[model samples]
Target chain A: MSKIGALIFGFNEYSLEIANNIGHKFGEIEIFSMSGAKEALEKEFAYPINRFDLSEDWGDLNERFDMEKSTAFCTLDDTAENIFLTISLRSSFKNLIIIAIAQNKESADKLSLAGANKVIPLVQTTSAMIADMLDKPVITEVLHNILYEKSSLKIAQIRVDKDDYFDGKYPTDIEWSREHGVIVLSVMHEDMSSEFIYSSKAKHHAIKNGDIFVVVGYERDIEEFEKLIGSRCDVSWSHWSR
Target chain B: MFKGWIVDIAYAINVSDSYIQTKRFFYNLLENDSYRFKKYFDMVMMALIFASVFIFIREVKYHVDDSLLFFNNIIISLIFLAEYLLRFWISSSITEVIIEQSEYDLMLSREFRLSKALRKIARQKLEYILSIRAIIDLLAILPFFHQFRLLRIFILFRVFKLFRYARSFQTFVSVLATKKFEFLTLSIFASIVIFVSSVLIYVMEANNPDSPVNTLYDAIYWSIVTISTVGYGDITPITYEGRMVAMIVIIAGIAVLAFTTSLAVSAFTEKLDEIKETKTVDDISKLKKFYIICGYEHISKEVAKQLVKNSNSLIVLDEDPKRVENAKSDGFVALNYDPGNIDSYKRLNIDLQRQVKAILCLRESDVENVYTTLTVRSIHKKIYILSLLMKEEHRNKLLYAGVNEIVYPKELVGMIAREFVGKPVAFEVIHALRSDYTNINIEEIIITPRMLRNAPLVADLHNARYRVILLGVYKKERKRFFFNPIDSTILEEGDYLVVIGNVLFIREFERSLYR
Candidate 1:
């Protein structure tokens, strides 16, 4: 099994925040800065820092860490620099997971095109949505518990190993959240493309082998769901160790 | 027995139903501009005022026809007299006044005094007659008497009656009325200058035979003409002292002219923004419901854009002029008013119970957001306020300040990042659903009273025929969101169905359910 590690680019506020918040979850973390090591020393940044040049081939990265097992965060304050870093990292490692911070929708689109697997737009669109949905107090409590507070609400990806059960089952065939004890959010195809289960397009697609079901539920419920579906859990968060 | 009978008659007249109805009808016709019937009444009144003034002007220069004279003198006068009496009658209720007087006498264990009640009623009517509007109305009707030469002079006051009909004229008067202090000061200064200059010119030029300033009247007229810059040139002072006096008066005239123009211009400039703001408020009030955004920042912009997409009217308010301008350029109704100011809320003229759906305090700082929330809450006890909490520590303070909802952007972003690191696909699905990057959206449709009456099951909504997914049902009465509610669960009024699908399909599903 590959060890879980993180490669964080840029020594800025956003990068520092992500490192400080989710840094310990990964087994190892390496922070890269465009500026020299002296500035990092002056600030006394907690994470181990490395100086990197944009034009250089990442020869030291491959030798130091397993690229497939590691996740890279491109969080440089400058949009162009972040995009270029994402492109370089993507070109070097095909299996590496890259998440980039975008200041706006335009940059977010550009970052995605530049091979970032996920783009976190720095705007408050998500928060605004959650705020609008706060009329239902239970949802707010659930979301808050899942986010800032520790709770049993685990979001996991279960790989479909047994093909016969899901061979011809559409996403809407069974009640997943009620009878199954899990809210199946989306289904990821073998090709890495995913669609939200509730979407109209998702209604046409059938679940099959090698498909991954992303679900949100309690710890015991998720485990039970995994056993019932006869699928191995590829990844799970929220109930993991600090 | 006779006295008792007389008292009964008076009581009957006081409570007469037809009398109250007639009075109410006239009150609505004259005072309620929004009443449909008042529009017609106003038009007729305007036509009469114009016709009477026209005839009065015609009579000044030429002979008037006898029939037109009779119409203006009799028909219009009778209408005016009726209007005056109606206005007086409505100004105070005699029945209420008499009832109160009799009640007071009974409380004191004394006989009811008719003369005392009459005195009180007369004083109230006198107060109404002394008012400026009533005085104008009296002058307008007096010209119809035509027999009193002095009352005929009041015919000019008929023109002032036009002020009552035209709303724009009232606005203009109000705008000038705000500069009462400045105008008062300016007029005093001008008067002093005119007085001194006229006296000086008279003393210097009256001794000469060539001078037209033989009396104080001529001097005053000359000074006024010079000071106003009319330069009639009918009077000239041949002496050097008089010419010097002319020079001083002319310079003073120019000074007074500049000061007056600047004062008027400043007053208009100050009132122009207020007028525009009032118009915006009026327009918003006309909407059945609307939202007020306290700041025009990125979060607010996003919320506003979404609200606009959902076809909800909103007004963006920002103290920052630049942000306000940006919002305006982006095709939003934006006002440069500070959210932390109580006067701004007062200016909105929000009816505490309706029209305003919510106020979103999306300012960048916690202090500003909290202050805005407090200001809004202080004035509107029940107005829904949603504030953006910049820091987690300020959450309690915001809630304490009476924010109905607090959205912490940092925590939300942090959560997204954590989820992105662990389950990228789930992150993608959620991000796509929220950003409208994909055509999918998680929308909440309220099960209105129309739908609850039918008592549809959740299973019906979950059917594939709707072409949407029923994620959950938010039971409003219970204040809980039941995840994937049981198929047998009956939908209740105010319960919100959280569904995800293409926007068009979701709308279709809502319409079908509502139907």
Candidate 2:
């Protein structure tokens, strides 16, 4: 069995999501929160946990957790103050990977100065969210597949507007794979539900006005597809709320 | 006659045609004269005639046979009557004595009737001061018997005739006319107090021997003196009823004085405050072609310093007095008030908003900058605005909010730093270009399509007007800059010409291109 340990501190909804996401990545994940991670274990999953107050002594936290065994410590505190805790942990556990959140540029600077392994501003998350929505329904599912099941080819969403020439065509009839070097994985209709267009059920379905075509291609091929779509097309996701 | 003399003076001053003709007539009358003393002599004679009227009034009170006074009065009346007849003869119309000669001519030439002429005469009567004064002078010199000595009190009304000679008196009259409503309110209050006090005194001291309020007339005189707060002490109230009336009068007098004093003080203070406020605004605005920053926030300090370093005039407008004072302490011209207020804007002379080179709104919040941008755009549509946007989502909103440029400070600083770390030398060059301390830089210019005519190539533009090199031209059409354009590359009007040179040469080059 591969022994893997995770340290989660300052856990909120976002931190909990990150914890849940990271749990599936490893064989054994030990979660720790500055508050409430232990209580959360009773609902669905069980892991060895340690709870510590943020205001408590750093020395007591060092004595409690075995730093060498912990593979990664993630801080989800949306402030520069989290970097101090990260620094304290980094001093005890020299090889542990530390990732922390920053509220803004100024806080990001302080976090970087405090020697966290990685510091990401909250705005960076928004940027990532924007980049993801630019790829939409399938891209999200593909990301989930890659992170959980180690998939190579991934699904991505592409918008079809009035200006696009591919309107009113069936996906199966179009030679997207041969001509454009991309595969049509699925199609999302105007009602915002996805159908696997390459499957038998969706073979007869014609492309409508507000259809989103799900494509699976290499990164370079995706780049080429984006260029073909051109910069004039508005790539915002109307369904997702930030 | 006095009207003719005034017209003569006016002609001597070259103000009217009749005056000019009369002046010529007078010049002919006093020809071969080394001294032009007739004008001065006439004025002195008029003064003496007025003085003698007053003297005659005082003398007639003592004696019945005032021979010298009567003779003097007759001579003055004859001179005045002759003068009046001469003025009437020289003029073209009967209405000339009352209406202005120019107005009379205008009306008569248009064939106005007697009724129309009378209306015109009445309208001009108030304007014809010389004619009115001459009429008063005629009344003063007219002879009267001992019983009509009371009529001689009309001679005191002649004192008003001196006003025509006095400039200060004319000014006082004009001011009083303008402030007629204020004076009327004051006088009404005074009259009410006088009427009430007089009636009370008459009722109270009807039988008191020591009291000066023995009659209604005496009571009126006493009331006048008391309410004026003069307290002449020529009259006193001795009875209980009299004392009660006196007490009420004294109290009312105090109230009236206080009320009038407060009114004067408030008006004076308000005027003084307005002047002071305007002076402060003027001091800030006198900084010619200054940048007006409409808010005080974190970015303002750096912006102010940067502008100051470039020797550019800066006027900071902030509602917080302390912030304004702080900016002033930091060597910036600052106005400690809202720039958006109409009165404040007026005081700053910002209605002529073209004088301001640029407006900057860097308030902590995007909403505040949005409002400031709107106000700036309303005042001057072309003024360049650099505003700070708090959120990335608000960037589009602020762009449509009328700001020429929106800066997300966090993102900008981060990007700059990132560039600095990635390409140090390139970052240094960009920094030097942006700095006030450095000489070389890239400049952005807007060219319209019309300016593309004749194809003045960019290569020839180098050292054409100033010793500046045209590095590139950014065409909005192409959405890219053409680096180092040759003679073959055609120059277009709406192209932004990026030039590299010293600051002085760059400025001269810009001026030449624009000119």
Candidate 3:
């Protein structure tokens, strides 16, 4: 039987849903609510659930959690209390993949401080949603479709390399949509908004050194774009590596 | 020869205390105290001799005993000639004056004398003072003609002496220097206005003889008075064409004045508002037992509702006064203040230590959260500071500032959304606590220092029939929490028992703890 992954002690409903959805993809799913963890455990015979209340004494929790056997323990609680619980449980279940939720940048730091393996922020997800919506559906849909197919749709932002073929050439002049098999959907201007989408009417829109191209392409195309345009991926993976 | 005589006189006038002391020493050694009197006598005798020469020259000019006048003039000239040569003989040589011990001492000690001692004083170069003395010397010895006596107007050159006393003139110079640009701009603008108005008025009023403005300068004068709004009415433009020009000038002048006034007023008003807001925030913060809401929004409204129900002491701080006023109108004790300012915290009596129990930082910006937490920590380190951070990156910064709790609205909302989608029952319980329709609410009770010493077990509270179930205990010392412990687990000091039921259960649980 595949090992069941359980997300416990989180205050958020969406986190539990996400964990359950992710868990259902692999094995049995269980959510041990922090508020009613004891009641849930007392009625364990009636329901297939595991309970762990963060409000309990740390000593009792440490002893009880040591006996549990699960693939991982994920927490969606955005409090220092939840993060401390996750860290304390990490020693007993060294192999348990610990995923935690952060309320904001501060809580994410606390989670990182508590030695969480993965800390996802709720704000960044929302910001990403806003960024996607503002950038338009067509480009987002294309990126989504590619990522959905289990292929990393690397949308890299590259500065126009002065040495490249399209260095000083305008977007219209290059005819990028037909040549590279990848669309240069938009360009991030210095003022922080997408530009080239609106520059289609202008006869000559010269590419500058600092102009970042938001190109949609496959892994190979991304690699080619990186090599040709001297661009890199925008996602900061420093936190994940740590 | 004249240049040498003038240099000697300057040397005498520019003498220092040290030089005088050395001169006294030489006089004492040479028994030359008589030389000082002798020098004065020689100058007087020289003046008398020059006077006689002047009288003789007048006699010769009138041809009255001209031969006798010539003889007298020659005798006086011979006497002055001897006197001038005698002065050179008595005066110190250039080399001796330059190499003198006292001169070298004075040069080393004084900045002014150092330049003089270096033979830097060139003759006739500083002729402003030299000319006055030389003229007096010349008047004493030279044969003066009556016809040339009218040339005394040359004495007016004495005004050049004012430049030597120029220190007092610095203030005037500085005023001119500073106002140079302003004066230039004003003059240029005035000239343009005058030129344009004059040309227009002249073209209009030139055909009409009845018009008072006869010349271009007169029209310019009228334009100045009219545009300045002075309306002296000394020169009126009677013609309709002239009046039309005047109307255009008046309108332009009014616009310029309005533009200038509005710019100044807006700038001053903005600064005044900022200062007033700062002071008001400081005044509000000074109140005891006041609650500080860091941000203004729906969450702030919820926080305010809970705070106002328990206590009337509450002050809401927001960058926007409209939002703060809106909160105030809603029966909240609100004050428009920026929590980032130290004065805002201090105004709410936050520094009183015991008065402020909690600080709620609910600003949308994580940067603001970090700043507020740091500021609050400076005044009261132990206060229950709850901050809302927009980003997870600021958690460590908030924690380092001694913040006890942090709330992320987006994360909480997302979690709530997920719960509503997946587990409807759990969601309902949370909804009741947060909903406006419900009276009952769930709040975390902090285990006080007093409660820990009593060592009350979970089962011992049965008399109260507190439906509250002991879910867990958080051990602060071990920095961990126990969840769903067995019934036999012993209750220890400093253990927080997480219980669930209702407000009544919470009250009973506390009551049982006392028992």
Best by lDDT: 1
For A4-115, candidate 1 gives per-residue lDDT tens digits of 6788888765666677667546878878889884564735767788889899798888878878768888988788988999999989987788888887889999998998
Better of 2 and 3 by lDDT: 2
Model 1, B386-476: lDDT tens digits are: 8888777899999999998777765656666676665555555555655556677767778888877554788766444666767677788
Q: Is candidate 1 or candidate 2 better by TM-score?
A: 1
How close to the true structure is residue B117 of candidate 2, measured as C-alpha lDDT?
48
Candidate numbers, best DockQ first, in rank order: 1, 3, 2
Tens digits of per-residue lDDT, candidate 3, A30-146, equal 555556544544453322445465554445433434323432334545476767777776665554546566655577787767766556655543333322322222323333343
lDDT of 2: 0.57
Q: Local distance difference test, per candidate?
A: 0.78, 0.57, 0.54
Clashes in predicted model 1: 0
The fnat score for candidate 3 comes to: 0.02
- Per-candidate TM-scores read 0.69, 0.37, 0.30
lDDT-wise, the better of 1 and 2 is 1
lDDT of 3 at A176: 53
Model 1: residues with Cα > 4 Å off, grouped in runs: A1-3, A9-25, A30-63, A77-95, A109-115, A124-156, A166-187, A195-207, A214-225, A232-242, B1-132, B140-160, B174-271, B285-287, B460-462
